[model samples]
Target chain A: MTGREPIIDIRNVSMRFDDTLVLDDISLSIANGEFLTFLGPSGCGKTTLLRLLAGFESPTSGDIFINGQRMNDVPPHRREVNTVFQSYALFPHMTVFENVAFGLRRKKLPASEIKGRVAEMLALVKLEGLGGRRPAQLSGGQQQRVALARAVVNRPLVLLLDEPLSALDFKLRTQMQMELKHLQRRLGITFVFVTHDQAEAFAMSDRVAVMSSGHITQRGTPQEIYENPQNLFVASFVGEINILDAVITGHAPDHLEATIEGRRGALHSRRDYPDGQRVKVLLRPEDLRLSRPEDPEAAEACFSGVIKECTYKGATVDIQVEIEGGKALQATEFFNEDSEDIDYRPGEPVRVSWVRGWETVLPDD
Target chain B: MIRIVKAAYVSLVYAFLYVPILVLVVFAFNDSRVATNWQGFSLRWFAKLFGNETLLGAAVNSVLVGVLAATLATAIGTLAAVAIYRYRFLGRKVLSTAVYILTIQPDIVMGISLLVLFMAVRMPLGFTTLLLAHVTFCIPFVTITVLGRLKGFDTHIVEAAQDLGASEYEIFLRIILPMILPAVAAGWLLSFTLSLDDVMVSFFVTGPSFEILPLKIYAMVKLGVKPEVNALSAILLVLTFCIVFAAQLMMKERREK
Candidate 1:
């Protein structure tokens, strides 16, 4: 999907529903054959943006271009984009085969072609023998597959999925996430998936756009978003991370020093900030390492804190260490049989340390 | 003892509701022309009912008006329900609420209002006026019925149709109509029955030249309650049962499958 020309370009689109603004100046350029996700909390405008792009709605301001053609006035029926709705939205009266063949029939395709295409789509979605069944007869996952087949059978230029997997159980959701990603790759159609699940978005999207309060807070690859959240909301919303109020005590061209309570830690920032600037620093739980206070390698900035709580997660143990100023910092460590620190109990004193570059300095807002 | 008492009470309520109808049905089979006494069981009254030219003509007229009024009302009302469901415009709330008001309003009031309107417009008191009045009342019933089905109806399915290259017409034809057909049919059946059973509105608008079964029965009852009316009422009751039973079966099939 790399180096492909832009397919759907949404420029400064804003949507307002009566008195409330649903989407605020959302601008995005989707590359052809790329799978992008709009990841956000509920009422954060991700679904609204997807609706706008699918031509279910026209923007209150700005324009949307599909294949570089203005699609502002194009109705959903005339647009080349199709949607896999959150509810699956399969026509209850139609059989699975009929549902998938609906778009082809609308195009006035020959009967044989419509049959062949519907059959092929059913096969693709692994619903080959169940075409005679109505949507109500199928399970949730099967209905979802029918919906996907129905949307993709038309070979739409862009497939917009609005939280399509939200209705499935956890196990089914995980399984369908991989299948949907695989299908998108196989089809190579530009897909814009909207979801509130960060894990699902991270697992499938090539680039995830994080939205909050009707604004795109950040748009980047999953790793970039997880490791380098630009704002406090993105940092907290994307995944669990420790946010600490720190005062910038020293400023340098490429580095800065922040003091939390009486302890100072060095951080590498792209831009220099003035001294005494109040900012928040985000530290991932996985990035924090715990060691004994008397261990030989107590180098760099290490904080001494009493363990407030320790929880044994399946793969890793989450330990909350209370540092100075009564602030609790969470640190996670994977379980190892040979590891001596696995038995770290509550109220035990420990030293927490992290490398300089692992910390993300975020804007206060 | 309590269980027996409860059962007795339930039976009493059922008897209270059905005894009159049961008596009417039993008398309809009586051999005598007078309805007061039970004569030997025979189908003479049913034969007379079929033999009566005026009553048979009115019955035919009632069927014609029922079919026409129900069809027209269902068409207009289903479209109104869809429009009220999908689009937001001025007076949408008032229009939808008006359906409920119309349904709950007294039949005489609606009939009198229509009569006044027809009189004011100088529309002749005849089949056209009667049919129009029937359709006007039936529209609210159809709207309310279809609206009940549309309560949990997924708007996303409509959007999905449009997204899949279906125009508004195609979406309604292929998706919306089929999805709500059961409700529409239920509405149409209800409207048909209401039109068939109607007397007040038909009495207000129908001229002597154009008569419906209910008004004719009302006139006959004024003259005297006869075995023929009993047989006709029993037949009408059976027809209503068949239609309602069929509707229930359809609904059950949809639920089960």
Candidate 2:
């Protein structure tokens, strides 16, 4: 991801709408042919950043570069970028063929060439024989494909997808996610996708930028963000997390000795903390292992808790545990077909512990 | 018993609306000049209507004004609707509200005001004044109609076009115009109908040299209700019906598409 000139560079970009700032000062770069996603809840400026890249909205401050050329003043039509809007935004008056051919016609390409290219694109999107149908005649997923084919048919330097699959049902959305990722790879075009769905972002993005309150809080690979969040917001937003209060008592060679939930435990951390420093420990739900309190191995380095409830998910069971100090934690255990002991009743006493060095420690925010 | 009452009420309403026009249509085919007595079915009044130079001239003038006023009003109003919908500027809200106000303004008040405006400018109250007055009244109707159509429009479609390398002009021409054409056509037809049948506004603004069909028919009826007048009224009614029918068909086709 280094040494190659970035296809897109957004430097110190800020956007304000009257009294509200939509995007704070932010800088990001995308490599050519790389798929990056801006993932956040609504009004987090993820869509605003995508719009800036598409040249629909200019930044109130700072500059945006596409293919090394500044795009602050350029109109969307002049810029080498295309967008698949959330609503699909297919032209209702035109057939699927004409909708895909719109940009090529705008470029004043020869009519025969336009026809052939449109047919090829239609075939690529698997809508070959349906080109004559109008947008209203097609189903939702077909409309989504038409939108995708329309934007990518232009073969622009950057393709911006503003939650293009959000309108689809769950199954279709999942299928489109895979198809979109494959299309991006096949076309070798830089894709800047915007969505609030963490799973969708993780599934398709080479890098994910988690945003909140108009600021990008963290940007990294999916595993990096899920396993190691920078703050509480990123930790809870990306996935389910168990945050526990811990007070550092001493430092070891590579780990810290801390009192967690009124129990002594080893805190694995990359950063150093002074003695008696207070911090928070982050753990994924699946990392916590639950055992019967009477078990000898569970007697040490564990927090005693009562099983509050058990939710039987198809692939896993979610166990809600109330720690002795009134802190509730969630633990997800995969379904074990051979074991009947996985079933736990409410009010049952249990001890919760995790593997050493599986926790992320951060200063309280 | 309830069904009978419902049918009677519906029939009564239709009769109340159409009885007068039905009388005129029936009289158009009357053999005698006397409107009260329908001697027999005849094409005599229809032939006389075509041969009367005064009525024919007025009919030509009315058609001319209707076409010209409708075209000009539609062009101006459609552009105004697009501007009000797409761009934000000072007084945009005020301008849109003003369009609605004009739509509800009484024709007599508009006619008198336009008359005063022409007098103040010392412009002759003839074809030019009549055309201007017709366009003025028709513009608000056109704008309101197009705006109604624009209410359901998706603005992201415009952005999508721009993202696909379409310029502002191309987006409007290729995307916006085609999408809103049914409304624009409806507005134009409405303007033409309004201009063709107008009596109050045209009464104040038009000069004696430029007589229109409605005013001419009014004058003819003042002397007496003649069979030729009935024939002319029936023809005008049919023309309006055809225009309205065409507009309905266009709107229905767009909806189905």
Candidate 3:
């Protein structure tokens, strides 16, 4: 993996279907053996981008180089890429063994080799003895495993999975996610997965490209994306965010005083914002706290507000506070001895705030 | 309230539609030479019908023409239906309209036009001519039946097969063919039934050298009502029911499986 060049290099690629511009000019480089995910909502062209990489569609005005060779006119059959579709797209007419053997047979590989490889793939996907059954005979998860084995038996340079786990139930999807991640690790081939599920994308990908409406909003490690999202879309898309519009009241060398709910505070940031500019601050639910206004010396912008709602979710508590400035701030706190006794019922006024710079201050919407 | 009304309407319409056929079927089993009154029930006319050599030969000719027509029509129509359904090309709308015209054309007009064209071209009017005309009439039936099924076909499955390294021909042969085969078989059987029972097209396209069962029955009806004719109609009815029922069973099994 270290010695080889990047497995796929997409340079300024754009695709359009008649009047619809499916994918805009985009460039991305994917390293070999890296688990990369294309994360986006519907109509984001993630599937189209995957098809372009698999040589199923031609990029309108750019180059797609696989293993350092430009592949534009090459058909999908000639390309070293296999796709596992969202529908699993299993051949309903063929048995599991036949479906997996289809590619090897196309290459005219020896019969012995074909059988051996299919058996090995089926075993890898943990469907070892189920090869003789048709797709309809198996459950959804089992059929999905067959689809994966069918695609991987070809030994593609990169495996393209288009929301392959979307159809499975929650428990099975979670189990398969772990299995797929491990399989990729063992195979050490570039795995470019596509899904709109944020948790699944974050769980499986080493880095993810979050696309919206045919353009990538942000591309980064899951941690980087969740912690330091570049803009409003990435911040809201990657995770649950409690956004607040705060005006800077004063600025210091290492901190700034801002008013969030008619409450002033010095926001200590390792970054900087102007003294008077209106900025939106993003606080992860867990980063917020509920306490009295007496702890102002140690706290940042403490809002004197009423606890309008409290949802007891076994391990953690979700509380919605009606803060000053006519805004409701949602926060989650862990169940501890202090929180257990404090029944901040509706209409009970409380100070809700967080430590300055506990969250990333995003650019204004 | 609406369901009751709809059921009543459907029953009345169906009774009106099938009253003639029911009359014919009942008369075939009456064993009486006259339709106004019933005599003793007997199987003697069925025995007598099987002994008519001229009627048997005409029955055999109609079967042969129907088989040939069904074979040719199903082959071309299924292919045309698949092509029209699967791919987009120039003049597709025009081609589709042409198919609609083929299905709706009156059999007598189609028969007369075919006769004049064949005669002007000096083509022989016999079994081959009758077969050709029947096949032309049946092509639209096959196309309509197959096209209905193809419309319900999951096209993504075909694309999936192709992506899984099956060549285009392999995809069709393995995936598309098996998926649509029951529809094709149904279409073939339907066309065969229509061609075998046809009178108008066969009337014009066939020369004196060849004759069909319907023409024979026509000639018999003109002369006098024969008990054997009713028996032959019973046999035809039974054969048609068997073919259609078997086709439907195959379809049901495919659906269940």
Could you tally the backbone clashes for each prediction? 0, 0, 1
Give the lowest summed-lDDT range of ten residues in model 3 chain A. A292-301
Tens-digit per-residue lDDT, B1-257, candidate 2: 99999999999999999998999899899999789987999999889989999999999999999999999999999999999988899999999999999988899999999999999999998999999999999999999988888888888998999888888889889998999999999999999999999999999999998999999989988999999998888888898899999999998899888
Better of 2 and 3 by DockQ: 2
Off by over 4 Å in 3: A1-4, A261-263, A268-275, A293-300, A337-343, B1-23, B29-31, B119-122
- At residue B182, candidate 2 shows an lDDT of 99
- Model 1 regions more than 4 Å off: A251-255, A298-301, A363-365, B32-34
Which whole-number lDDT from 0 to 100 does residue A165 have in model 3?
A: 95
lDDT of 2 by residue, A1-365 (tens): 22356999989999999999999999998889899999999999999899888888899999999988999999999998899999999999999999999999999999999999999999999998999999999999999999999999989988999999998999999999999999888888889999999999999999999999899999999999999899999999998999999999988887889998788888989889888888999999999988886777687647888999999998999999999889999999987779776689999999898977889999985
Query: Which model is ahead, 1 or 3, in terms of lDDT?
Result: 1
**Model 1: per-residue lDDT, tens digit, B3-107?**
999999999999999999999999999988788887799998898889999999999999999999999999999999989987889999999999999988988
Model 3 residue B42 CA deviation (Å) reads: 3.1
- What ordering of candidates by lDDT runs from best to worst? 2, 1, 3
Score every model by TM-score: 0.96, 0.95, 0.92
lDDT of 3 by residue, A1-365 (tens): 33346899999988989988888988999988889999999899999999888777899888999988899887777788888888887777678999899888888899999999999989888998898898889998998998899999999889999999999999999998999999898889789999999999999898899998889889999988988888888888877888888788887667777876466765655567777778778888888878755555424446778888999888888888888888888888887865454456888777776755677775465
Off by over 4 Å in 2: A1-3, A252-254, B1-8, B30-40
